[model samples]
Target: MDIHALKRQGMTISEIARRTGHDRKTVRRYLNGDRVPGVRKRAEPDPFDAFVDYVTARLNEDPHLWVVTLLDELEPLGYAGSYQSLTRQIRLRGLRPACTACAHVTQRPNAIIEHPPGEETQFDWLELPDAPTGWGFPTKRAYLLVGSLAHSGVWRGVLSPSMDVPHLLAAMTTLLALLGGVTRVWRFDRMATVLNPVTRDLTPMFAGFAKHHGVQPVVCRPRSGNRKGVVEKNNHTAAQRWWRALPDGLTLEQAQASVDAFARRQDERPRRTETGNTTAKAMFAAERLRPLPPVVFPVVVAEERTATRQALIDWRGNRYSVPPELAAAKVVVQQRLGADTIDIATTSGTVVARHRVVEPGLGVTIRDTGHVAALEAIAMASAPPGRPHRRKERIPPGPAALRAAQVLTGTGQPVSTVISLAAYEQAAKNRNTLR
Candidate 1:
């Protein structure tokens, strides 16, 4: 009879173990409702044992008798069990609500692949706001060119101007120097500067840069980011790591140094993807940096000059005081913008004094050394001989036409153009007057 009762409940040995607080092995020995010594034979006495008859009688009457109402009624009758205990007993009584089981479980499949050493690296450009370097003129926030290796997880980055041609060249040169050499193949997005816009081809600009550095440039397909997925992922990762290292209100150079140090540390980290491996190990063993050039880059200087009495005579924003012999003549002004250097020349190409452009509008006037020497020679030669007398003044034009002529001369355009513009202006003014 007990076996029949247990079988009707569908109580498995494991469930018996959990419910009765006995080991599964012990419950299994008592399986098939076999009674074992020292083990309770039947259902344990419930604390609500005394109320069971009354509760069962009410449930039989309605089958839907609320557990809470049943507990409330039993309370006055000296019932001591809590609501939870009565609920568990109700579940054991086979009156618990049934729920539909889920049809299937959904899960995401792993998509990561392992790469060998010296395989590939992802490249990207990250722009930051201009920074305050201690230089007198504010050096603006620039870009940091970044590259990350797929196998080793090593990262390289360098600061540069906008990701234009010149800046890109400088950045590539800097990165090659940092990494000890270039990689076999570099993967990056199809940036317009590097790829041909019309054809969507990566064969031209990248080819040139790659040839120079002895590496291959491979661009990710348009709208397909996962082709260069490693670098795209690393780009975000490196940004997070490097952004925090940027100095607050600091110079670009300072922020760059901070990023470099952080990158070095990141490279030293043991790879989470590869068990017991680090970036430094793979890069040092498999990667090699390009050799440095014998000579460093040259520094260019700039200058500013203003036009002179000799219409063309100017140097670095200063008027070259040409001799009276050449006054009202045209010459040439040459200046170097990178440094404080300037040169002046005649229309015939005679070289003049090369001097630095000075600050202030007119305070520090530069007297051309050659012009001064010519003046001194003239004065000395004239001091010994008697000077010529002054000539008489000429007659002026009549006032009636002179005033109108003065207005016409001050108009500056060719007289015909000025007359035409004035006529148009007067006609417009007359129409307004009519209105």
Candidate 2:
């Protein structure tokens, strides 16, 4: 630039080179705009270029593959480079193919949405696949129904055993309570339990549930999930931070408590806004969410449990008593939302037992007096009805065994059995004498 400026003042190239401490040829290159100031040709051939074809080919095979995983593969193939350098080269060259299916999920053009207080809450089910086997549900897939207050970004999650409609309702009720209240509008992503994605209409069951709860349901556009970005952002945070390194030995209820605690602790995190920085707890307190109804929407949330040998069925880490006769039988355990008691019924829907609810994961065993009495009577009834069987009675084999003896003796008839009374008579005499 100095050389060009000097030339613009009519200084010769030789004079400009002398003034700028550069040779005339170098100064001429700058004056002619042929040399960029910071760019220079590499003295050595690029080592990264040797692996470009391999990286591009692997990425073409799976565009969503992680760079770390690619590096692992690259190392064994003799590509010596830092992960940062490989990623930078791939990014600069646009080697990673654009995924048509994932374009909606990846970043793209979008407008920011401003939510009013108490206006909306978004709900989503984060599916945690291959969950710990000890979680005790039938399948390896576990679900968490998350609810986020759009305006305040306050979120709560309910760890559910399944993602079916009944569990969805149960979890949603619990999540709403954790959130303190219900927003006027509920946003969803066409969850099959709540909305029929084919018809784009509310399912009959969820429609009734929403009407009962007095909240309007809004399904996002077909591919525009960012409309409810609050919950989506939370889903990522939870999956990465909470579920990734989840502590072992946590039952479903224990994990529920853990995740709830995780959500609560996030309230202390600082959030920036146009006005000033604030915490979610502060904004959440200001939200004017409507009070939840006195009773939750009516839904039968049932789980199938097998009764133990003691005529008790396990539910939420607590055992509830059933009839002794139903021992080792599969029974239906149903608990209504906001109900104080849980009902244990036969597979045929006969109410066999009901137990007062207890806090979950307490390892408590609940047994009704009647059930205990019946179980005790059953145990006694199984005892010998008459006199207890004599351990050492003076008796001989009669029908079957004597018949076998007679046949062995070639008599072909029943044999008479002998009774020894001498020992008994002596014992009786001794007892009388002592008295």
Candidate 3:
């Protein structure tokens, strides 16, 4: 506009070109009001143009046909192009439907997270869909305690029956051992088992567990699970990739084994890192993890119960028998996380009984054979005496014994029953004399 204004003041095109450092033709175009810039077309033709129709048709057919697959088909037809170039052209032409949700989510600015090896680990609980435990049991929901190393994306997971403190701690211990070590920081969401959501404080049990592992416990912000997005994303990955097709009827131990195997397989796959593509197992090798403690944090859960007079202790709606002597005594039942056995001990820490934990709602009774025998013996020993013990059948008295009894009564003499030969002889002699 300034140049045109100068030109309107009767300046020649040559003078305007010299004054504005513009080309003579540019000056004339501006002066003549031909200001709209001409669109510059590409001088070279696109190599993908010839294959556009084919690509579009293929996309229309499947919508999700891999670009690589399409590239493979095109390569045979002399569509010489790099995969990147082919994808760029396909995207530019909008041949594929745009993933709106994905675009919306990925378009949001996200911080690029970086961590040194063994610096941080993110953990979360994934609730799996209800499935039968393969033990002829009703369908039950399982939880996966998933943990991922932030630096290497090495993941470890264990299936748990519940999300209680003991299960959570036990799962963490197992995952850390599988991961080969612990990280400097352990990250978690505001799960009640891990932290007090309102106070943002670690739960007492988890605090102790963290202390035992020598790792600092960090809780994510409320409602912001993405703070620990590494494990959170791995949770979805595990569920979709592994848990989706998990065989039915898996016991808890079997499910845990399956999860471990899945994690191992995942770690074997190549992952993209800042350095380049590498397997998690390979990267984990370089991680400077903290050595595991000599012993794992105790994940044993305990409950106190009073044994009934029948020597039965009730737990989780099932009865487990203790020693008969423990009847009407207070006992403690300790069940270690991930352990099948339940231990019943006296208040003084004497293990009186041990039985395999039964599934809920089974109405099962776990009675130790020794305990049962002890109870039977105690019952037999305390039975009253002088009572006629009933036999399988009655044996009638002989006719001679009946007659001897009648004679004794007729003589009004005290009758003494004797089994000795001398007594029998004396009774026979007396009988004969009486006769």
What's each prediction's TM-score? Answer: 0.42, 0.65, 0.52
lDDT per residue for candidate 1 within 44-90, as digits (tens), equals 76566687788777776666568998889999999888999889987
Could you tell me which 10 consecutive residues in candidate 3 have the lowest summed lDDT?
131-140
- How would you encode candidate 2's per-residue C-alpha lDDT over 212-294 as one tens digit per residue? 88989999887778799899999999999999978888877888889999999988888888999999999898899898888
Q: After superposition, how far is residue 391 of candidate 1 from its true place, in Å?
A: 49
Q: What is the C-alpha lDDT of each candidate?
A: 0.62, 0.88, 0.80
By TM-score, who's the top model here? 2
In terms of TM-score, which candidate is stronger, 1 or 3?
3
Clashing pairs in 3: 134-249
- Deviation in Å, model 3, residue 273 alpha carbon: 2.6
Q: Rank the candidates by lDDT, best first.
A: 2, 3, 1
Q: Which lDDT value does model 1 have at 362?
A: 35
Residue range 212-312, candidate 3, lDDT tens digits: 88889887776556677778778888999898998866655566678888888888888887678888889889889988998756689766677889999
The residue pairs in collision within model 2 are none
